[model samples]
Target chain A: MVSLYFLLFYINILLIGCVLVYIYKLRKLIGFQLGMTISMVAGGFFAFTSGIIFIYVYPFHFLPVTIAATLLGMAVGSIFGSFFDYQTLLSGYSNGLMMGMMSPMVGAVAKNSFLFLSFAECLFFASLLLVLSSARQT
Target chain B: MILYLYTMLGINILIPAVLFLTMKKKRKLFTDRYGMTISFSASLIFSLSLGTALFFTLPVSFSVLIFISAAAGSIIGLSYGILITFQSLIIGLFNGTIGSLMGTMLAAVIIDPSLCGLPSQFSTLLDRNIILITLFLTLLSLLSSLLLRFSYRV
Candidate 1:
């Protein structure tokens, strides 16, 4: 059977990616091509870091760290929202950091399998963003 | 024990996250203080753990792992937002290589793992002064990397 945690994690990632893409679409800051690329590349980093941060701050002292991580995520998100129009790497890193702050990390394995899974999340987000943006443009 | 394992898990996940973030080509962040701080912390954490692991495993595979970690760390450090100087890359690379060797020694004593290499060879390598010096250098390298920002962009 598929791991329940894995399912939740992917679904969470997909929902966040789509919502953010929609917001970006409304902002009218980034072009379709750049948005797709950023979502794909930035999404992977964002997911993996989210998983790592989740692993670090879960179960114990979750409240304090979660709050702090939330602030950090907002900082990251704000940075990205401001700079997406200009196309900057710092903005992407901050966005990745934000996404990392928001994701849940299931304490299942310590292997690198999660790395590939995170990339898959990125690709999934990228394609979905591409489709959504393309639809809106047309 | 659990902390180390958590950190191991954390680093494995964090490395790729940082790597993908660095793939973007921007001309501003790395040169800035905030960006450098993140890279410095990530490099130090990544190299130290891998280095520590190398000491215990002494497996040929660990060496390859060290190389990959170092490469990824440098790649991320050098390219994060703004292209950082070559000196920063060198500092990061140095941290990874030295950290691994030193970590090997520290782990041999702390975890005292029986694997990695011949007991006799390890014993000789783990001489008293070696431990002190390794500890000193590791700290020094970490501090210096964070403080110094050489401006040679690759």
Candidate 2:
């Protein structure tokens, strides 16, 4: 049987690719609403960038680490002005996939630390949310 | 609503869950994007709900709690008539950990010193085991629904 790490790595990459394709096809629908498109792109960018960062900085801190960032990105994007659109759906799924395949290595640096990661992600997402959303809206 | 919550308790988890229980026929080259979206979001919400519960209710700390919740959440996600694609499982596991992490933070607000960013004694009364766990678990589970997908391409 294949090791969980390698399995997750390849699978996450595949998911990311599929999401990109979906985004490409739904570009018009996403673009229809500027707010949703930007947020979706922001989420995807965060997910991809965070994945790369985790692979380098903390190779073992896969899922939660990357997910924390992606979720933060999505959270920020949605707060701006979310709607039921292709972009919104695809972005959420992409981020979800990123988190799912996050290395499955919960014990790399620390296990319990994920709580902290969530806090950090929330902080970042909240910060981004502040910028994306107005006091009246959010 | 109650059925979904019961799944979080791992009580009658096998029954009403069948509502979300789905089976995958195939992942086609030209797959129905909307359907995939439905599957992904459904599993995500389920994993997130159970994961948050695991972290909030368990006697363990965040590290251990996350592992347990992630495993259980992934299982719950996989059980949803998914085609068992590797991609889907990854997504589910991610939801689980993220949910657990959120729960841990909510609890840590009063329990974990390094967390909370507040004085523990100030919130001692709010830190009761049952109360805190129940409050955190319910709030997270319900709030997570807002993130669920409702619209899909038909």
Candidate 3:
């Protein structure tokens, strides 16, 4: 019975993954779609660093990834969040709820609080793109 | 006997399945090199600590060794959660706490079912449980990677 439950869960996750990929591809083919892929990626990295700090050093107590997710959207945030959540769960740490609470705190200390840092990163990239495009135009 | 095996298999499947589903929607989010490196390093550390805890079993040395193992495991678990999962502190903490709790719980429930009495037979049961959980988690991890790839296209 447990095995059956797990098998069903695994299948569901796989199906979801495939569906999301299909949608992503379709969006790409259509044209440029405003999204938060870069931020999400950056956030994941930030979470990783924070995790290390928490282990080896003082608990940095911030969550840049959660902030990114909030800024970007829940789908992206949850995806990244789930990864972190699952890893912690597997390792026998705290619950997901506790981790969520820590997210903003971690973000605050990481020298890149969500509100200001994400905007800055986004703007910087946008400007860089703009400059390159203008240069091409010339 | 078969029931126990099935239960263990279920745990293995559920964890990975949840991980895969949760990760699939935003696979692109994990593309950052920093997150991948940190997560991998953390996982390695965690695995090592757990290994040490499992292999060593001297009465005087056990407590100290287990404490160190717990600390190391927490660190690695947290790091993996934060970096690889894209800054999800919730995940980091959860990973650390859950990893420790599960290890202790397994020892208590499966290994030492009788608090007052110590028996060698308990060790065998504990070992079996550990193997089952580990196998399940590995499968889950593999599936998670595949899901990540699939989600990346979107």
Candidate 4:
């Protein structure tokens, strides 16, 4: 049943959330609540976006939607990167992997170079946002 | 066709995973209430603009009625995206850009599957299946968020 899939999906999400919370608590012990918050907010944002995309965007094969999502992530990541003590290099790496995974999807659906480029732009912008945020913080 | 589905599915998984990983490393970064709020708001606005753009671009027609409907649908989608994004932001929650993008794309795929110039048979099937899958994934994300909220309650 479709509801079953939905149930599984939610269960996985809950588990992930719990883990993140646990990690946040651990990080809190070290006075890194800021980092934890950033990560939580980012995760929340991702989950929200994923839901929206599933409900609306992919059916039509819109390129801008992906671009916008990537841009938002970059913005969030950049903010986190700027103020936190840790380097966002890892964030960048993760984003890159995501971007790589996404390219083929966009290509398959939209087949537009502009869409692909937008995804790339999002990653670059996210990296920039992180760096800028870090600079501003320091 | 399968490639497209797999890629979309992969993105669905990866976006959340990456966000979770990022948060696991730095939850405090989100505590800046102002910044998170702003980012969330911006994402909502971005989603609206994208939805609007999609509504207008697809369903290309030489006919007046079709054009009018397309324009109207674009407006509706844009408004809906904004509404949903804003609601989600208020709760100190967020989804990644990819998810938003996917939402818009899913809309387009449904409204204008032929726009991509795919073979009609494959695109149609893909479009329908994607809609189902996206729904499943969205539900999953919401459930996960709820779980996170409950589990993290101190």
lDDT of 2 by residue, A43-129 (tens): 544454344435434443232353455454455344322444654544454443434233223223233344544453454355345
Lowest summed lDDT across 10 adjacent residues in model 2 chain B is found at B21-30
TM-score of 3: 0.31
Q: Looking at model 3 chain A, report the run of 10 residues with the lowest lDDT sum.
A: A88-97
DockQ of each: 0.01, 0.06, 0.02, 0.06
lDDT of 1: 0.43
lDDT of 1 by residue, B1-154 (tens): 3444444445444543544354334435444443443444445444554554434333466557556545544453444323455555555455445434443443443433233221233444444433433333334333333322222231
Instruction: Look at candidate 3 and tell me the lDDT of residue A104.
Output: 38
Q: lDDT: which is higher, 1 or 4? A: 1
Off by over 4 Å in 4: A1-137, B1-105, B117-119, B123-131, B151-154
- What would the DockQ be for model 3? 0.02
lDDT of 3 by residue, A1-138 (tens): 335434533443453354345434443332111223322332333333333223222222122333332222323334433333333222211122223323333333443234543443354345334423432342
Q: Output the number of the TM-score-best candidate.
A: 2
Interface RMSD of 4: 8.3
Q: Give chain A TM for each model in order.
A: 0.34, 0.36, 0.24, 0.35
Give the candidate order by descending DockQ: 4, 2, 3, 1
Error of 1 at A99 (Å): 32
Give the winner by lDDT: 2
| Local distance difference test values of all predictions, in order | 0.43, 0.44, 0.38, 0.39
